[model samples]
Target: MVTLASMEPLLPDSSRELEDLAIELTSVASRFAARLHPIMRASVGDLVRSMNCYYSNLIEGHNTLPIDIDRAMAGDFAREPEKRNLQLEARAHIEVQQLIDRGEMPYPVLSLDGICWLHGEFCRRLPDDLLLVRNPDTGEEIIMVPGQLRTRHVKVGEHIAPEPEMIEPLLARFAEAYSFKMLSKLQKIVGVGASHHRLAWIHPFFDGNGRVSRLFSHALLRDLGIGSGLWSVSRGLARNVSDYKRLLSQADQPRRGDLDGRGNLTEAGLAEFTAFFLSCCLDQVTFMEELLKPEELLNRVEVWCNEEVQMQRLPKGSWPLLREAILTGEFARSQAQALTGYQERQARTVLSSLLDCGVLTSPSSKGKVRLGFPVDIIERWLPRLYPAVR
Candidate 1:
C-alpha cells in the first residue's frame, strides 16, 4: 500500500527557529574547522573517526572498547570469536568512513547508489558471522546480502518498514528530494536530519540500516562543507541514546490531524527531530572547540608531560618540544635542540623517548614530527572522548 507519495514532506516546515539552528550550526562548524592547523586537523580527524565508530557501534548494542578498536586498526584482533567479530565490525565502519572523509565515493551520499555503497562497503568488510539476521517472529535465519535491497519484509520495534518492492522508488524519491545540488545551504543542513529519519523509516536493507543512515548523515554534512571530520554527532547521540531513539520513533508517527501539515507522516514530529539532530551537532562542535582551545589543550598536555618528566618516564625538557608541535602542528627534527634548549644529542634522546612512547609521530625516520594520539595519552590529551583503555 505504501507509495512514493507516502514519503511526502521530505523536509520540515521552515520555521524561524529551524532556520536559526541551521544558520548557527553552519557558522560554528566553519569556525571550528578553520581554527585547526591542517596537520592537527588530520590527527584529530583520525581520533574522531575511531570515536565515531565506537559510539556508532555502541548504539547498535555492541560494546567494543576504545583500546580494542585501536588494536583492530593495528591488525591485532581479539582471541575470542565474538570479540573479534565486533572488532572487525568496528574496523569496517572506520574504513568506509575514511573513504567518505577522503571523498573517494563515486556517488553522492544522498543518492541511492551512495547508500548502497555505504552498506556494501561496510558489510563486505565484516566477518561472515555478522551477516546473518534472525527473524524474531518466524525464527527464520536470513542471510543479509551486502548492498542489496531486502527481498523480504521486516519490522523494527512497532514500525513495519515499507515493502521491499517500494524501497527502490522510495530511495529514488529520497535522493531527488534531498539532492545536495538542489537544496540551499541551510536547507541542506535541515535536510541532513530530515533525510536521516526518512532513510531509517524506509529501512532499505535487511540489516545495517542504522549504520548506513548514520554514515549517510555524516557524508551529507561533509558534502555540505560543514563537517570536517573534526566533530561528529555520533558521540552526542550515544550520550543521549534514550532521547535519540525516542525522537527517531516519535518522528515515525502519522499525521496528527490537519495541524501537522500535509504529509503521510507528521511534519511537527519531523521538525522536532531535525531540531534535536541539529542541536546535537552544534553541541558536539562546541564541545570539541572547547577541548581543542589552544591554551587549555596545551596546558593539559604540559601538565601531563611535566608529571611524566618528574616521574622519569620522559626525558627532561620534553614539554617544550611537545608544546612546539602543538603550536606549529609539526616541526623539523633539527629544531628539537633549540625548542627544548638542549644539546643536539640530548634533544635527539628526548625526541626518541617521545616517539618510543607514541606521543609523537613522523612519516619517515627524518620526517617532520606531529602530535600523535596514542591510546594511552588520549585520556590525558582528549579526556572524556571515551572510557580509558583498561
Candidate 2:
C-alpha cells in the first residue's frame, strides 16, 4: 500500500495558493454549517422532506441537461440512466457504506487500485484490450473503446497520453503513497482530491480514468467525514464540466517549453483548479444554507398570503391552519384540518388553494407534500454536497 508520507503535495507552489483556496472553501462550509438553525429545530419529517425537495429539483436539472456526463456521475442520471454506471456507483456506495459502518479508523481501504476502480468500478473488470486509445474530436485526448459512440461529440486530438513505463516508475517511487493510510479528516480529504487529480493528469489507464477520478473523490469525502453516505461530487464536477476539463488541462499542461505536456506541471493551474473546486463546494454550502434557512420558506408563504389577507377574507377562518401547514411540512388534508381549527371541508379548500397558488407544492404523489420547486433556487447551486456531517 502506498502511503502519503512517501508522497508530496502535487501542486505546492511556495506561494501557498492551494492551501489558501482549501482554507477559504472549508471555512465557508464551517461557517455555513454553524450559522444554520439547528436541524433539530425542524422535525425529522422536515429534514426528510427537505432532501426530497432538493432531489426532485436536481433530477429536473439532470433531465434538462441530458448529455451532461458529470451530472450523471452525481447520482442524478435518472433521465438517460446507464445501467452500468448505476451498478458501479451502487457497488462503490455499498463498499464505502461497509467501511463507514465498521467504524474503521485510520481507514485502511484507501488502496490505489481500489480507489481507481471505486470511481469507475463498473468497467474495472473490462479486459485491458478494450482500453483502446482514441482522440475525441474536441482536440482533447480521451480514451474509450472503438464501438462505443462518442456521446460528447468530443474533439479528438493527437494522443498526449503518458507511457506506463514512465508512470509505473513514478508509481513505484510512490507505491507506498498509493496505499497510504489517512488518519485525519482534513489531510485525508485534501489528500484524496489531490491524489485523484494527479492520477487523472497522469492518465494512468487506457480507459475509465474519468470515472476513477470521480469515484476517488466520492470515497475521500466519506473518509473525511463529509457525509454519512456516498457523496455526489461527480454531479458537482459534472455541472462545471468545462471548468473541470480546463482546470485538469491547466494542471497537466506543460509549465513552459514542454509542448508534449512533459516535465513538472505548473502550480498555478492546480491552485486555480483546487480553488475553483472548493468554490464549487461552497456553492453546496450556500444551497444547504438555503434549505436550513427557515425564513426562506416563511418568506414565500408571507408573499403568497399577504395579498390574500389584504384583498380577500382570510379563507373563511382557515388562515391559521394554512399558515402552519405551509410553514411546517404537513401535506395531509386531515393534518391540515387539525392544524387549522376549521371544518374538514374548509381545511381541504384552504390547503388545495395554497397548493394552487404555489405556496405549498408537492410532487404528484399523495400523502407526501412539502415545498417543491422553491428547492431549485439552490439546485444548480449544489456543490460537492456534504464533505462533513451529511
Candidate 3:
C-alpha cells in the first residue's frame, strides 16, 4: 500500500537543468504577454478556454470536435446519445474552468477539500451515462458519488490504489508538501508538474481522476499567475498522449536503487516525468507566442478581412476598424466612423456586419468593440490552435 511517506522527495532538487527550465518558462510567459494588448489577451484567453476543453476531451478519448463544442455552447446538442453526453461533458469542463480562472473556488488547489470539490463539481454536472464506470474484467458496474471519496478498493490497470481509509491522510500530506508557503515560485511551478503525476498515482476517485488531476494542475498554474488562460498544458499532453501516459506510468515505479531517493517511489522517475511535463508546458507557451506574434496575426486577419470584403460579406473599408481593433486590442464605439474612414451610415454598416459575423464583440450596444476570435474564423485567424472543424 502506498502512503504519503512512501512518496519520497516529492519534488526534485534544484539542479541546473531544472533552473534552466524554470527560467525559460518565465521568459516565455513574459514574452507571450508582451505580444498582445490587454483586450486581445482577454480575447485570446476565451479562445484558449475553448481549445483547452477540446484537447482535454480529446485526451479522454471523446473526440467531440471543436466545432461541435462551439455548437453545444450555443445550445445545440448532438442527436446521438453518446456524442451528446460527450458534448455536455465538454461544456461542463469549460464551465468549471471558467470558475477556476475567475478564482471563484478559493480552496487551496492541492488540498483534499480542493480535489474533492473539483471532482464533485465536475462529476455532478456530467450526464447520466458518464456517471457509470464498468470493471473491464468482471463487468462490474460502479456508480460514482460526487464530492465523496471512494469507500471501496479500486485498481487502475497495474496500479492498485491505496486503502480507502488512507485517501484523506495521503491527500492531507499532499497539501502540506505542495502548499504555496512551502515552495518558492520556481519550485511551485515544478510542483505543479510533479503533483500532476502524484495525484493521478493516488487515483483518489473511481472515475474522473484523470480529468480532476488535469484540472487540479490547471488551477495550480492559474494561481501561480503563469497560466494566464492564454494557453494550456492539456493541449501539449493530449498531442503527446503516448509519451505522456508512458512517463506517468514510469513515474509510478518503485525506487530504482539506493541513489534514487529516500522514498518508496523513484525520484529519478519522478524527475524525468517532471522534465517532460514542464517541456510540454514550455512547448505550449512557445506555440502560442509564435501564433500570436503581432505581425503574423495581423496579416492573417487582414487576409481574411480582405476576402470577406471582396465577397461582400463585410462593407467596404471595414478592414481598417477591424485592423485597428486587432492591433490596439479594442477601439471606441464612438470612433467607429472615423476609424473606418467612411460616412456614418456606411461605417455603421461595417460595424454591424462585423458584429453580426462575430469579428467584433462588445459587452453591450454602447460598449467598446473588442476583437473576437470566433471558432468558425479560427482557421484563418488562428490556425492549428485546435483541430480545424467544419
Candidate 4:
C-alpha cells in the first residue's frame, strides 16, 4: 500500500536558506494585510473573493468575465444555456468560498470531512451537463458522485493518482500532519503552500479536485489569518499557469536519488514548488498593496467622476461625495447634500445616480450608504484586476 512515507519531507529541510524564504513570505503577507483598514479589508476581501472565483474557474478553462460574474450574483445569467451554466458555476464557486470565509466548513481544512464537504458543496450545484466525464478509453460515461472518493482508478496527465483504496488512509495522514494544532503558525503558512500540490496529487475525487484543492488552500490561508480576506492565491496561480503546472508536475516526480532526502519523493522539488507558491502569493499581495494606494485610487475615482460629469453620465459635483465615501467607507444620508455641495434636489439626483451605477450600495434605500466596487467600473477604480472583463 502507498503510505505517507512516499510523500515524506512534506516540507523542505529547516536550513537557514529555507527559513529565510519562509520568513520573507510571512513578513510580506503581514505587511500587506496591515495596510488596510478593517472595513476596507472586508471590502477588498469581498472583491478578491469574486476575483478568486474567476481565476479558479479560469484555471479549469472557463473564461467567464468578472462583470458577468457580478451580473450572475444579481441573478442575471446569460441567455444561452452553456453560457448560463458557466455563470452558475462561477456563482457556486463564490458561494462555497463565502462559506469558507465565514468559517463554516465542518472539519479542519486538511481533514477528510473538510475535503469531502468542499467537493460536495461545489459539485452539488453544478449543471447536469458538467456532472459527467467521458472515459477516453471505453467511451464510457461516468457520473461524478458528489463528496465521495473515486471508486475506480483514474489518471491525470502523466500522473496516476493512488489506487482508490488508498485514498482514505492517505487523507487521514494528510489531516494528521496539517491540521492547525499540529503545527506552529509559521508552519501552517508553509503548509498552505506545500499542501496545495500534495492535495492535487492525492486527487481524491473523480472530478473537481483542482478547484477543491485550491479552495482548501484558500480556506487554510484564511483560517491562519495570513490571507485576511484581502488577497487570493488563485489570481497568482492563474496568471502564472504554465510555471504553476510545471512546478506541480515536477513535484510529482519520484525521488531523485539519495540527495533528495529520505522520502520516496524529491525534497528539492517540494521546496522549489513551495517557494514558487509563496512567491506568487507575495507578488499578488504587493500588486494589491500598490493598486490600492489611497491617493492613486482617489485620483482615479476623481478623474472618472469628472469624465462622467462631462459626458452627463453622472451628475456634477458627485466626486466629492464619492471621495468622502471612499475615505470614510460611508457617509450619513443627511450629509449627502453637504458633501456633494448640491441643493436638496440635485443632491438626491447625484445620490441616485451613484446608487444606480453601483458605485454605492445600501441594504435598503433608507440604510447607510457605503462605498461599492462594481465590476463595471473596476478597471477605472481598480485597474488590472482580473483581466479587464475581456
Candidate 5:
C-alpha cells in the first residue's frame, strides 16, 4: 500500500505561518459543507450557474472549452463536432438521473474491478474512444485497459500526472465510509475531504480519475446532506489548480530522514492540503448561500422551491398548467395556458396547484406575484428534470 509522507513537509515554504492556517480555515469550511443543502435549490439560475461553473472548469482544466451546456444537451449547436470531454459530461448527467430515479445511493453497489467500471451506473458509460483521457506529451488519449485508466501514465491539463485509481477497493472504501453508522454532518464533511485527498494519492484509473473523483465527491456531499448537488468541488480545485497541486505534492513528498534511509511526510503539509481543500468548499458554499437571503437577488424560481411544502395540494388540473408556468419561468400565467393548451380555468387551476406544492413564489407583501429570484434557475432545473420526470 502506498503511504502518505510523515507529518512534516519535505520542503518548507519560506513563510512558516502560511501552512498552519488549517485550524481557522477548516472550522469555517466544515460548517459550510454541513449546510450546503439549505442553499442548493436557492435558485434555478444558481443551479445552472453552479453547474455551468463545473462544466467550464472541467473543460478548462483539460485545455479546452465547451459550448454552453444548454446547446450541447439540446443538440442545438449543430456545428461543433462531438468531443471526448462533452461525452464524459453527458455520461455524468446520466449518472445524476440514475440517482434521482433510484431515489437512493448506488455507490454502495458500484465496483470497479474489471476493465469496465460501473456499467450505466449513471445511464450510459462512454466508449473507450470517447472516455479515454489524452496524454499531454504525445497528445494521445488511452482507453485500451481498465487498470490502465488509473495506473497508465496518461495526460491531463498541461502535464502528465499519475492516473488515479477508482478501483474496487477504493469504491468499497467509499461505500463503507458513506454507510458510516455514526453519520454526523461534521464526520461526513471531513470524512469526504479526507477521502478526496486519499484518492488522489491512490492514483486509481488511467483516465478520468480527476473527473470521477469530483463526481464522487459531489455524490458524497449529496448523500451526506447537500440538497441539489449542484455545486461542483472540481470548480474550486480547478480555480487554483497550481496551488492545489502544489499543496498536494508537498503533502505527498517525503522528507529525507536523518540516516534512516526511509522518507517521512510532513504532517503539516498534509494538513495544509486538507485545509486548502476544505477552504475551497467553504468558500463555494458561502458564495452560494448568499443567494438565498431575502435581501440578495436570488433566483426567484429557487425562492419558490425553498418555501414550505406543507401547503395543501393543488387540485389536479391546476397543477399541470401552473407547474409549467413556474417551471418554465413564464411570468404571464395566460401564456401557460397557450403552451399546455389547457382551458382558462384548467390552466389557472394547475397554476394554483403549483402554489400549493410550495413550488410558487410568495406574492410580495403587496399580494402580487412577480417572477421570484433568479428566474434563470428554471432553465436548468426544469430541463434537467424533464428526462427524469418519467
Candidate 6:
C-alpha cells in the first residue's frame, strides 16, 4: 500500500524558532571546538566516541560497561560467551564511528549508499549470535543481511514498514530531499533531526536502523563542520530516553487535521521532534563546555593528583608536569625536569610513575606526552561522563 509519496514532508516547516535553535547550536559548537587545543580535542574526541557508542547501544538495551569497552578496544575479551559478544559489538560500533569521524566515507551520509554503509559496517562486525532478529508475530528468527535493503515486509510496534519494493525509490527520495548541497547551512542542521525521524520511519534495513540513523546524523553534523567530535548528542538522548522515544513516536503519526502541513505525516510533530533533537544537542555541547572549561578542569585534575601524591600512589612532583600538559596540550619529555622543578633523574622517575598509571601517553618511546583518559581514571578526570566503574 506504500509508495514513494508515503515519506512525505522530508523536512518540517521552517520557523523562526527552529532557525534560532540551529544558529545557537552552530555558535556554541564552534566556540567549544575553538577553545580546545588540537591535541586535546583529538584526545577528548576519542573518549566521546566511546561514550557515544556506549549510549547508542544503551538505547537499544545493550548495557556494555565503559570498562569492558576499553578492554575491547585494547583487544582484550571476556571468557564468557555473552559478555565477550557484547564486547565485540561495542568494539565494532567504536571502530565504525572512528571511520566516520575521520571522513573516510565514500558517499554523503544521507545518501542510500552511505546509510547502507553505516548499517553494514556496524552489522558485519557484530558476532553471529547477535545478528539474528526474531519476529514477535510469527516467532520466526530472521538473519539480517548487512548493507542490504529489506526484501520482506516488517512491523515495528504499531507502525508497519513500507513494502520491500518501495524501499529503493523511497530512499532515493529521502536522499534527494535531505541533500546537504541543496539546503542552506541553517536548514542542514534542522535536516539532521528531520532526516533522523524519516530514516527510522522508512526502516530500510532489517536491523540496526536506529544506530545507522544516529551515525548518519553524527556524520551529517560533522560534514556541516558542527560536530567537532568534542561532544555527543547520544549522551543527552540516553539520559532522557523516555522523551526521546516519545518524540520519535509522535513524529511518526499521520496528519492530524488541516492545521498541519499538506503531507501524509504531521508537520507539527516533525517540528516538535526537531526542536527536541536540537535542544538535546545544544544541552550536550553546553555540558561538555562546562566540563572542559580550562580553569575548572585544571583544578579537578590537580586535586586528583594531590590526593594520589598524599596517598603515595603518585610521585610528589607529578602535578607540575600534569599541569604543564593540561595548559600546553602536550609537553616534550625533556621539558619535564624544568616543569616539575626536579632534577632530571627525579623528574624521569615521576614521569615513569604517571605513565605507569596511564595518565600520560606518547606515540612512541620518546615522543611528546599528552593527556590520556584511561578508563580507570575517567571518573576522577572527567566525572559523570559515564557512570563510575563500580
Model 1, 91-145: lDDT tens digits are 9999999999999998978778999999999999999889999998999998888
Could you tell me the lDDT of residue 218 within candidate 3?
86
Deviation from native of the Cα of residue 374 in model 1, angstroms: 1.4
Q: Looking at model 3, which ten-residue stretch has the lowest summed lDDT?
A: 1-10
Model 1's number of clashes is 0
lDDT of 6 by residue, 228-283 (tens): 49998899899989999999999989998999999999999999999999999999
User: Which whole-number lDDT from 0 to 100 does residue 8 have in model 2?
Assistant: 37
The TM-score of predicted model 5 comes to 0.56
Off by over 4 Å in 1: 180-182, 387-389
Q: What lDDT tens digits, residue by residue, belong to model 4 across residues 137-230?
A: 6788999888989888888899888888988988888888877476767677777788998998888998899899899888888877776467
lDDT (10s digit) by residue, model 3, range 1-390: 666677667887667777678779888887887768989888888888888888888888888888888888888999999889988998888888988988988687878899999998899989988999888878899888887888778877777878888888888888889884867888988888889998988788888888898889889888887855888989999999999999999988888998988888888889989998989999999999999888888899999889988987788888888888878888887788898778888888888888988889999998999998777888888888876667
Off-target runs (Cα >4 Å) in candidate 6 are 180-182
Report clashes for each candidate as comma-separated counts.
0, 24, 0, 0, 35, 0
Residue range 1-390, candidate 5, lDDT tens digits: 322332222223322343333333344445544543332333343344435334434534533232344343434434444554454555355445345324455334223431123323321445445545566667866553533435555433333343344244444554555456775455455555555655555456554455555555565555555432444455567676788878766666554355323335555555567667766766655554454333233344333344322343334343333344333334555555674577877766666555543345544422423233222333333333211211
Alpha carbon lDDT of each predicted model: 0.91, 0.46, 0.85, 0.84, 0.46, 0.90
lDDT for 96 in candidate 3 is 86
Tell me how candidate 1 scores on lDDT: 0.91
> Over 4 Å off in model 4, which ranges?
180-182
